[model samples]
Target: MITLGHAQAIIAGAIAHAQNAALKPLGIVVLDAGGQLLAFARQDGASFGRFAIAQAKAHGALAMGDDTAVLAERAKGNPVFFGSLVGVFDGGLALSPGGVLVRNGDGAIIGAVGASGDTGPNDADAVRAGIAAAGFATGAAA
Candidate 1:
């Protein structure tokens, strides 16, 4: 279960990681297993669009039960379906590479974390740092 504290911890850790890496100001979003937003934060200079992109990426991760980067790779093989899904879901799904699913030691999904306002790899790394800091595992497959 993802309590409020857990959500906040994830966001805080992600933000810290971003700052430590000297990355751009980032927007971070946390979502529960049900795909509901649990917590969110935008850094001082983060762009307005970062919030939506971060949320969409996290939502996409939770929806597909996989990392957003994996989904993005899969989308490349089936653009039509993925493109249609964007329209169907009111653009709530993003196949970008900034989303990471949060899991437990037993590998059960608890939630997701997403970051934006930097390159895809940097965003993903920040999210991973947060999940690790919160004592949770990341759902991205090896």
Candidate 2:
């Protein structure tokens, strides 16, 4: 279970990493395994579009059980199918980057973290750092 404490820690860790790296102001979203929003925040100066993007990125990862980067690749290879998913999901999915799954000791997915405001890789790095700080395992790269 992803508790409030865990969510707060995840956000703090992600923000700390982004600050340390001098990345742009970020918006982060955490979601439970069932795709419910757990915690969310947007740093000062984060863009208006960041919140939704971050949420969608997390939802996309949760829905597909893969990171957004992987989804991007899959979408690129099969635009029709991926596009259909986008439509079916009502635009709640993103296939760029910045999303990662959170797992427990048993390797069961417990949650996800998604971020925006930096480059795709940077966003992903922040999310990974956050999940690590929360003492959760990250599943496969996808």
lDDT by residue (tens digit), candidate 2, 1-142: 8988898999999999999999999999999999999899999999999999999999999999988988998888899999898888899888878988888888888888899999998999999999999899886733
Off by over 4 Å in 1: 140-142
Best by lDDT: 2
Highest TM-score model number: 2
> Could you tell me the lDDT of residue 54 within candidate 1?
94
Which ten residues in a row are the worst by lDDT in model 2? 133-142
Candidate 1: residue pairs that collide = none
Compose the digit string of candidate 1's lDDT tens values, residues 2-98. Answer: 8889989888889899989999999999999998889999999999999899998998888778988998999999999988888877887888899
lDDT of 1 at 123: 96
**Alpha-carbon lDDT of model 2:** 0.91
Please state every model's RMSD to the true fold in angstroms.
1.4, 1.5
